[model samples]
Target: MKKILVITLAALLSVFFIDRSYSKHNQAVIQKTLINEIKEHRQEPIVTIDFRKLYDFKWDEVYVFTPGTSLKNIEQTLGFTWLDAKSTGIKNRDDMDLIVFVENNQVAQYIMLPRKYGTLQPMAQKGNFMVKTS
Candidate 1:
């Protein structure tokens, strides 16, 4: 009977040690799916901005959240209107000023992973970060 309890406790503890942030494998799969969706929908990169400038800029504001964060809570987290770093006019190039999604207890970054997931998955489908619903 004690062995059963030990096994159960071990299993529960294992879950806590699991890599919580969306894994690279998971994000890659999602990115691949989204990339295919964009291709099917005829979405192409139309604008080219100096992304390095944004990356180096001392962000005017920054927010970090674990994977599966709700879009509805964003305003509450920021205590103001929802603002994306890409559109903000605040530019100071020393560090990245952006909302960060982390994986493996570290920042998750995919250089070409288009930030238009919300436009592609408006309903916040599975694996999607932003949705237009309450």
Candidate 2:
């Protein structure tokens, strides 16, 4: 009976340690991939964004965008289109509707709304910092 109990406990402990290690490793890989994707599409010679600071308050993910960063750039980096750029009213300085909300110098959320509608619609968001979208 004692030997059986000892073996079961050891197995449980091993599984727990293995899971923790795998989670950490997976997160590191995801972070590295995101950074590389951003760097590959950015117009600047050196990418300046520090990805470590943008932690998801709930989902454990990161979201980033800058003022001049175009919707096309985001589409290329993320490999998905959230909204049509033409419909977002991002024409010239007067019609521009892109906004990058930041907290503590890190991009918390990005929104693109049409000028005519004048309503907030998140193009990309992360965690509890911004409204969740489907």
Best by lDDT: 2
Q: Candidate 1: what lDDT?
A: 0.40
* Model 2: ten consecutive residues of lowest lDDT: 125-134
Worst 10 residues of 1 by lDDT: 125-134
lDDT of 1 at 32: 70
lDDT of 1 by residue, 1-134 (tens): 99999999999877756753444455456447544554554543432222223243222333433333444554465554444433322233222222343334333443224334322221222223322111
By TM-score, the best candidate is 2
Give a tens-digit lDDT track for model 2, residues 50-106.
Answer: 333443332333344333456687556545555543444444334324543345534
Residue 16 accuracy (lDDT) in model 1 = 55
